[model samples]
Target: MSRTGRFGENLAINGIDGSYGWPVIGHTFDYLSDTYAFGRTMRARYGDVYRCSAFLQNFIVFNSPDGAEFVLKDEASQFSSKLGWEAFLGRLFPHSLPTMDFSEHRHHRRIMQSVFKKQALVGYVPLIDQVVIGNLRTWPTHQAMPAYPAIKALTLDIAAKAFLGLELKQDTHFINQNFIKLNNGLAAIIPWPLPGTALHQALKARSNIFNYFSPLIPQKRRSEGQDIFSRLCQAQDENGADFSDQAILFHLSNVLAAAHDTSTTSLTITLDLLCQHPEWQQRLREQCLRIDPQDITYDNLESLEEIEWVFREALRLFPPAPQLFRRSIKECQFGNHIIPANTQVMVDCGYIHRSEHYWNEPTKFDPERFSPARNEHKAHPYNWFPFGGGSHTCIGLRFAIMTAKIALYHLLRDYSVFATEQARYRILPITKPRNGLPVILTKN
Candidate 1:
């Protein structure tokens, strides 16, 4: 590995004719510094599909819409998510559905789906509305605040109330700290347990969540409450098979982390986008107001079609989980190119979203791209996978949309949102503003 920016002759690949790849260090340093940087560089040099070495593996990045389509919608088994994040998340959330595949994955996903259905969320409407209103009431009437942390608190509160049927005001700080530790664990370069390490703290947080929810699972079972947690406690498959207490707890933990974290990340991005585009924000605000602001019912929620489009656009620009990786199950040829088995494969959503062929003005903040008239995403289904595609698409997609819309509805009704000039934003794997998203909210 040379200190120089150029890869020395010693690190070149032979089979690809005169072409070269990364050497001993290869693109590892570049990737760690910024995966998007590497993707942009590689895509420019090698076109849509290119092979690069990372973390001591020959990884192929599918950078085009067609390439992603092949990777996601495979006829034969080729991709595996477990190979990428299982070892780390397994420790944090043992036996989660995402950590499994095939029959096992299907079985768990079926049980998980029961909790996220429209009927279940209908039951959560009052809980979500109350959480949003309660959090909004705490915001300073005419002060500037970082939107990420504020949205995080609101989303966490919603997760606590809607998922666990428990108010988290007394333990909000603890829960927030645990959530931060859990996210840091995922971002860690080394995903191993060490004394005082991020992974270790995340493991501890997992312990805390399980301990907090264990006793309540039985209580929910006894009372048979209308909340989703209670529904999960007694949910059964078509064959009458039910999840054991341990399985239920694992699923609950994963759901809470997934539902809240990704949604909060998404809401933060949405807030940032809305703040940046006040014309669109005013449009969305008008839409929300037209449907009776006092009554935040399910019907009114559904009528928020424009807000939904703005959210879809925000996700297009800044998806929370931007890059997806999978390992080859067997040796195969991708478009006549040999992709050997065990090769690391990546789907670069960030690049695909910015690609010129699929989108008209790729970088612009145009919510109309998602409108029924344009619906540019419909140009290529895989072109816009904010929540991924295929069988593994987010089961909680509808719930996430509802949560974002409801939060935005409340925020716009009483407050005006605009980005802070002093705030400089950065996009990590999760699209949070590196500097907290500072936004001025005036009482409207």
Candidate 2:
């Protein structure tokens, strides 16, 4: 069938307006090719509430903060995160928190929350600092290096040590390799496990991860270790029910991926921005110098005001998870449109984060916009939701922040970084440097 015929039969029947692009493939190519441009073009042409098909499914894109708030908060209990993420991550990461819904999601999140509480987070600081400081020291000073891959490797090591309690180099190396394969599969347009496909490799990686952690779970549950893995093994809900073996495996896989991927992206972008604006780098470095590295702790991390602003601005500019997905469980009204049950909903957070209507000089790398004097993000509750909002917000919100601050503190305190002019980025999957963010670290 033609594009209009397909759209009319599927989308228009529900009273939503937008193009389905092609018949079967829809706008998959357009979306995967340039997610931001496609989103911006759609908003410009069809406004906030519009329907489009991609990855063999129909999605109603919401580009406004209010729309984001509605789906994220789910005050009416009208959406299912499980159904929403199932298509993308189900095969690769089954039973993970992001793929869970409503009550089940809450139950699992509550038990998992113990591992990220303030006391647990405080213990993680030294683990993070050790990995970061050691890695930064090994980085060749005064020589240009690809910062993205380097930081990606560093964050993976940190995740291994801090989250999984894996310190052996060979063990961390194995986890890093497989996790990369698993992450790469998330962007697969075809989610099949056919030979040599991204999904096939990811499936294999998932099995490998399961095998690696299966034997360790029993041992971890019996111990009182400090790493997240041990804590998770020992964590119990109100009913004193600990996670089953399968649950532990799933949670560990999900948390390790989340811990590293997001920090790597945020840190890469923040470093690139600082490289492009040395004035801010020097200013942030000066602030870091004042605080003795030994004085930096989870409780005092917020005291490094300049570093926090810079990282927050980087997240605002390029949120690692730019689009938050949800599926309507029942017919619901979102703004002026009626959304039918079982419809996939995407909050265009990337667009909202940089919308001219919501921010002054939205595209500029101005960290001061986040300062208390300015507090531009305070204009709207949903405006700066990089970690998401409401009940479904990232459980690791503070952990990710703490990890970023500790890494930044160690690096900036010892070295000044300079980017090779004009570093560009690609936004799909997650925002990352197109050229790996090449930069040189110069000892101060």
Q: Pick by lDDT: which candidate is best?
A: 2
Give the runs in model 2 whose Cα sits over 4 Å from its true position: 1-14
Per-model TM against the reference: 0.91, 0.95
User: What is the Cα root-mean-square deviation between model 2 and the actual structure?
Assistant: 2.7
Error of 1 at 182 (Å): 1.2
Residue-level lDDT tens digits of model 2 in 1-444: 212222122233246889888987889898778777787899999997898888777788898888889999889999888877776788877798898887898999999999999999999988888899889878998888999989988998888788878775777668877887888788777767789988888889988999988999889988777899999899999999999899999999988887788899999989988888889888988888888887767877878888999999999988988888888877889767988876788898888988888899998988999898999998888889999887889999999888888998888888989887667777766567788888898888
Clashing pairs in 2: none
Against the true structure, candidate 1 reaches a TM-score of: 0.91
TM-score of 2: 0.95
Q: Top model by TM-score, which number? A: 2
Tell me how many clashing residue pairs each candidate has.
0, 0
In model 2, state the lDDT of residue 18. Answer: 90
